[model samples]
Target: MSELLLTVKELKDIEKYSADGYVLGYEKYTFFGASRFSYDEIASISNKANVFVLLNALIHENNIEDFNSEINKLAKLDVNFIVQDTGALSLILKQISPKRVVFNPYTMICNKNDFSAYQNEGILGIGISSQLFIEETIELSKLDNALILLYGYEPIYQSNRKVLSLYQEAKKVRFPNGQLYLREDTRDVLYSIIENEYGSVIFNCKKVNLIRRIKDIKEAKYLLIDTFLSSEDEIDNVIKELNE
Candidate 1:
């Protein structure tokens, strides 16, 4: 059976819900995290909550020093890091045990060969890309040390450039909103978009519904529920289904 893990975008979620573990995001080191937590604020987190860091942003060359300093400090605390950049993964492994790190390159880690290559490095887990079709996911779930996305708006695109601000500058008026949506010419559904100082990320417009399918995915080591931009009502509904 897989362990149920949830993203803790707010402190309230920690008190209101239950799960095997929690993944928290801070504005400094994570992209697509709904909450803001400075380095000092989140470092003081209690060990009892089983909270960890979502350090999945692409670390740029200029910020490597700050990034390295942050991870090394975080390593001293009781936290596991879910990292995205391959460079970031190497740095994190040096500071903490490979068992405490999960390399989640989002769209990478699709096949068994790629999966095994990472596992051989002694990392705790690797994210099974949300872009993979259900059949592909079904096959990959049979493997060990897999972190599968069970629900929430999945991030399909990420960029280190300021997409929103650049567009706003071009338009001659401040867009005044970081949150926007995009739709293909032929598509009806909108893709959720959010931009921050670090970069911009585009997410699936709709939640990936797999709450009821947990039983079928018995081999996934961890099932993640990311609540990036979801509502409390939506979370409650999904929690109800998980309980059922």
Candidate 2:
């Protein structure tokens, strides 16, 4: 059986959902996603519940040092670090001891070969893309320590530029992180968009719901649920519904 992991974006959420399942804190995001907690807050959480940290970011050499400093603090905690970029992975693999990390390159892993490649590189695990079909997911699950995205809105597009910043300037409006969204003008579809100092990311219009297929993907070691866009009540409901 696989374990349930909840991705928390707020401090209050940490308290709300930590009891039901393992909590994953988003430490940084250079493309999309919402808020990140302070090292102190993360340290506090680690003292209580089973926790992990997502250091998924598209980083460059210039900002890599700052990124390293932040991760170095989190690395001290007894938590897994899910790395996304090659540079970040290299930094963690080379600098961090014991190599407690998961390689999740968004939608890059298409087959078992990809998993083997990552494993060979000393990654502890890999995050399976939600875009894959259920059958494909089951096939990928055969690999040891496979991590799959079982819920949340899938990211469709991400860019290094401050897209929301430009949009806000032109529209004369303020669209803070986790508050703004993008949609097709022709129809009503909610593609959530978030902007930070790093860049902007626009998620898919429909959030991925795979609770019904849990049994099928149970072979996977971990299933991740990103709740950055979900309200407290919504997250509570999802946890109840899934646990029941």
Candidate 3:
């Protein structure tokens, strides 16, 4: 059976609810961080919760050293890391080891070959792409170490450029939370945008609600729930639905 892995966006979630298996977004590139958390802050949260750190930031050559340093520090906590960048993976493999690594290149592992390559690399677990059809996911879940995204906004675009910041400045408005939205000119689709020190990432407007389909992926190792840009009550309701 797969475990429900909730995303800890706010300290209030930690205070109000007990997340035995949780993932924390500590830096700017992730879901929670309009305000970045220090390593000490991360440690404080991990001490109270069973935490897995999300280092899904898009790493470039310029930030490789800084990224490596962060990973090295996180290794001391003895928590697993969910990595996106290849450079970050190399650092983890060298400094940490594949045992503590969970590879999630946001919508990249779509087929069996991808799964095999990752498994051969000694990766302990891998995230299935959110963009894949349910049938593809069902086929891939048979792989023993698959991690499926059971609920969340699917990430569509990510870039190091501060697109949201520039747009906010041009519009003469500050989105304090550093979140905004863009709608298609032809279609009625809206995409959520989050910008910070690391860069900007745009996600699908509608949340992916697979609470009803959990049985389809029970053979997997983990089921991820990303609670970004949601209210406290809304999050609680989702959790309640999952439990039922």
Which one wins by lDDT: 1 or 3?
1
For every model shown, what is its TM-score relative to the native structure? 0.94, 0.88, 0.89
* True lDDT of residue 31, candidate 1: 74
Candidate 1 lDDT over residue span 99-208, tens digit each: 88988888888999999999998998889898888888888888888999899888888988788778888887775555678888998999988888779888988788
User: Model 2 TM-score?
Assistant: 0.88
In model 1, pairs of residues that clash are none
Decide which is better by lDDT, 2 or 3.
3
What does the lDDT come to for candidate 1?
0.83
For model 2, state the Cα shift of residue 66 in Å: 2.1
Error of 2 at 50 (Å): 2.4
Q: Each prediction's Cα lDDT score?
A: 0.83, 0.75, 0.77
Rank by lDDT, highest first. Answer: 1, 3, 2
lDDT over C-alpha atoms for residue 137 of model 3: 89
TM-score of 1: 0.94
How large an RMSD does model 3 have? 2.4
Error at 75, model 3, angstroms: 0.8
Number of the top-ranking candidate, with lDDT as the measure: 1
- Score residue 34 of candidate 1 by CA lDDT: 58
